[model samples]
Target: MKSLYAATCALALALPAAAAELETYLEFEKAMPPGNLAIGPDGRMFMSVHEFYGPELRVVEVMPDGSTKPYPTEDWARAPQDDADGLNGVLGLRADRDGILWMLDGQGENQTGRIVGWDTKTETLHAIHYIGAPVARPTSFLNDLAVDRDHGAIYISDTGDGQNSAIIVVDLETGRARRVLEGSQYTIPEDTPMVIDGREITLGGNPAKIGINPITVDPTNTWVYFAPMTASAMYRIPTAALLDESLSDADLEAQVERYGDKPISDGSTVDTGGNVYITAMTDNALGVTKPDGSYEVLFQSDDELPWPDGFSIGADGYVYATINELHRSPALNNGEDASKGIYKIVRFKSLADAVSGR
Candidate 1:
């Protein structure tokens, strides 16, 4: 959704176009196109591949030198739906302050999912929390997750393949995962349509709309925020309400609050200072929302960041994003491979730096 005329003017004045800039951090010439990113406390960058053209590693660590290596072990990245190997599709990743790398791994065919906890210090996967049939159905599509280390819990957004969507929460201590607010208003997308560069997104000549996609937890872990891919409004529910198994589905859904609105965003991440940075794909720009709910256009370049899909914020106050040049793929152009290996992981200064005269 376009901003109000007055807000647009204020944002333009706040962030001068001349200062809007990004650096080419890493370029992928191979087929391992990235989907999302998470930066460790010590500054190591980990990314998810989300099943590329043929078969590639699902998770990798970006070395300081810019080379990529499969994380944990290559066996986990092995091709051919290895249930024994313990991972099918990795869509989201977040490294909490306690040195734990949390992942949302979903198996679409079986409609099964698991929230995994990888101990970066020990270099091993210490936990595998699964979502069973009653919660995650054949239609459920678990897209991304937000980690709440303060309460030892993790929240995931299940943006189903079709129209249905829901939120799933897991308790680390007992490894119990439950589906809350299934098919609720907060989880499903409204009537808003998705169009980029004056073209609609379609798969097999049908309009493709994604729901309940991007999710992020506030730095303080007070609330969990999520928004649909095709909707403008962002909603949040109290972290306590989500972790409270005593609450009924109706009671938990009642806690959802419409914090505000945002442009169509793909990926989101929150900094230690509590500012939320999101990739606004529609405007071909990056947006930053302050604590008070006001947002600004940090930058909107035409040539670069055409499809800012995911983000990872570094301790040095820089945010890294993967520009999958062709966002929704060549099928958006009638079944031709328009993407010519032009994928890049770009970095820009912090949101505060981008808006201020830094």
Candidate 2:
């Protein structure tokens, strides 16, 4: 028998240096681009197509044989491009151990936010709730989310779409959402210009402030970890403290701990052993952090992983992510859809274990 730490070490040694070459898992037509990756318990992979604009297929499940079908239903994905209800579509997804597919949705036009849960096992729409008003303001990006099943709560990060940032906590059982750490350093973005492939990333002719993009919870569900796209360090807070709305803003801020210095990351996930896997935006690779808060490069990024946007651990222990090719989009490239290549979904050997609180 082997210990979890020893297994992780052996798996790391099995990976190649300078980053192992990644294989293309799936490709999408330009009309329907990729958003995020979510692997379910049975090895079924789900992806959220770009939100809003009422995409033909907003949420599609990637079959093991290399085909895709609209998840739940196509009608369920008809996100109103004009702002009737922003919650109609999904931009992020996570399949929990309970066999439920949780989706993170936002109205790009109005910055409205919503979360929906679909019971994959029973094939039923489980729950749906909207994030409105104070918690989710007009500028909220509602970028990503992570579930804490222990207390029946879900934490959402508002990227501020460049203007601000905050974490929105919702009680799944009660349908109550609370805004925490608003405008704090943890949620604020430096908007540092990112240079990938010698091309500076610019959106709307200015540096993009994609704050609080990635959020993940640890195995015991004790801490909820998070980071901004333009970031210096990843932060974590006690899950119990985050759920207590009675805590003052100052008190909650005090609970935040600088887990460690990290690179600009778009997505992050944690294995059961407490190893944190994050997208290495600077070197275009996969980076991991130990439980002690030490960081190291796992695999260098390449191919369809140009912009690794979302991450999830598969049932087989592989880490999966999506190649958004975001920097080339017309929305950021002055209306010129300059995607260097085709969009795709990719995965790599995480070597650790499945995500926490799953």
Candidate 3:
């Protein structure tokens, strides 16, 4: 269902003029594209270099002048050959209120998923949790994650095809993990074609179909929201119900709520007023879903936001997003990378104040 604001915005997109333009925060000229970003309380910007393109570095810190450097250390940014503990492939990252940066490593083709938390305040390791086997299957592409500090847990979206897709719950206190809602209707991708510019993106010669990719926790940590990259609706479940190991699959599914409708999206974040900001990838725009299930387009770009991927709200009350042109990647472009020069990290004002790292 289209909200009233969305209905009006849909009509606005029909006009030739631009709706809103994003402010350029950082630009990547010769570097690999960024996957996700997290802004610290002190204003430090950290981003994960997308692993889909086989980047040399896993993570980097965006300096004041837009230059990039290995985050924390060169060694940590570049994993030693055959070293599983090193930062292998990070995409989803967030900053806790305590200024601790949490990075989620899907481990690339290795499939050794792990979560690494770095204490920016003290320049130390806060925690490291490994996810494997029963919880992370061979086909699991651990995409994005949400840190529920209030519940002492982390919820990850396992976009393992559309059949085995599930939301993984990891206990922050004990590092135990369990896969819930595996292959449920809520977690699986809809039979929607991911078309960009009139051409459907293909992965391995077939139409790219991703399931339950964008995931985020609300400002109050009350609910974990997520959706399939090919689905049109956002779904959420209470943090309490997710943390309750006693709940069966059906019980967990019963608590799940279809929050609102959204376009094909990649990443998301929320503000203090329960507004969820999501990257409207198909439209090359940014949008938000309000507390009352109303969704509105905040901005739509003409040429700038080509495949806006991840979102992070900074302490300055701006929403930062990565534009990587993923549909042009080799995997999606029929074995030929069609991305042009310069990826970007852009920021726009949020409708409401937001938690620094989400």
Candidate 4:
């Protein structure tokens, strides 16, 4: 039998490269604009169909022939009515080394949120944890997440519509969760407008400002790196402090440190070498935040990458991202959906080997 690494390498070669540095892994029609994405241990790619398009299938598995099928099951992708495992609306998802896919359901302007884990290897439910009330408020938008199996915890970025943003830490063992750094400068958005393609993005006739949206953890799971979507700097906090229930909010705030400068980005993922690849939303590029707090662009294209929203490392030693034209959505385009061209999923080789699903 072939090894896992060898299998990944073989599958990667099936797709022809589109550019010198990037490969167009998949493309979709106008209706299936993708949100966040994850690749399983066996190279099966999954993504949440962008909620802005009001899709019937919320989560789907991208097939080898560029088609999509309801992930896990058709019922699980529909509205959460009778089936408890149904995904209401998912924006973020990640697959771990153990073959479990963890999906974050923000519930789309609803008051409650949830995290569901399914064991891909066994095709069975692994765990489900509800997040609401004290930890998540009515305005909470659970944008993205990072799984730290070493600490038995999952860190989420609650981009509370630019007002009450914070980091929510959930204990995998107890299912208890809490919000930290609430209303802090590091989590709230700066007074800046998001301008893409020479036009400022607006929602309801006002600038669409978002708080902490891009969040990721290093290969070792020692530090959590994050930043506000409208801000120009990245920050980090030790994972130990986030899981400690004894620490007060003030103590936790003290542990936060500015890691480096970053562009206005949407999602990020790290490699084994501590290099964080960030999606530069405004610049239409992907840049890396180095270990020494320096930044450089790895790839850029005006036509190919519009709003690069999510990031996930695959077993093939490549980082995958979704290029959805979110800025053209009705919410950001003043009540008119102006999006054109095919929604694309692209991949490029990572600078170093990565822990898949981070």
Number of the top lDDT candidate: 4
**How do all models score by TM-score?**
0.87, 0.87, 0.90, 0.90
The better candidate by lDDT, 3 or 4, is 4
lDDT (Cα, tens digit) per residue for candidate 1, span 1-358: 3568887678657543433676888888647777789889998889887553433688888888878898767877544354467467787888888778887887666446777788888888778888877878787878899888899888888888646688888888888788887778877877766677777767557776777888888778998888887777777889999988899988988899877667778888776655677788878888876566777777787677677888877777788888775544654657666665667798877755555445
How many clashes does each candidate structure show, in the order listed? 0, 4, 1, 0
Candidate 1 residue pairs in backbone clash: none
Candidate 3 residue 271 Cα shift, in angstroms, is: 0.9
True-structure RMSD, every candidate: 4.9, 4.1, 5.0, 6.7
- Candidate 2 has a TM-score of 0.87
Error of 3 at 121 (Å): 2.2
Worst 10 residues of 2 by lDDT: 349-358
Write the number of the candidate with greater lDDT, choosing between 2 and 4: 4
After superposition, the stretches of candidate 1 with alpha carbons farther than 4 Å from their true spots are 1-19, 80-83, 326-335, 352-358
Between prediction 1 and prediction 2, which has the larger TM-score? Answer: 1
Q: Model 2: per-residue lDDT, tens digit, 1-358? A: 4698897786556544323556667777776677888877787788888642235677887787767787866556555466442236677688887888899877555455689898988888899888988777777777888988878888898888655588989999889888888888888887576777787777668766568888998768899999888887888899988988789999999999888867888889887777677887656777876677778876664553576667888776667777767767777666777776556766666545322212
Off by over 4 Å in 4: 1-20, 82-85, 108-111, 353-358
**What lDDT tens digits, residue by residue, belong to model 3 across residues 289-316?**
7677878887777488788999998877
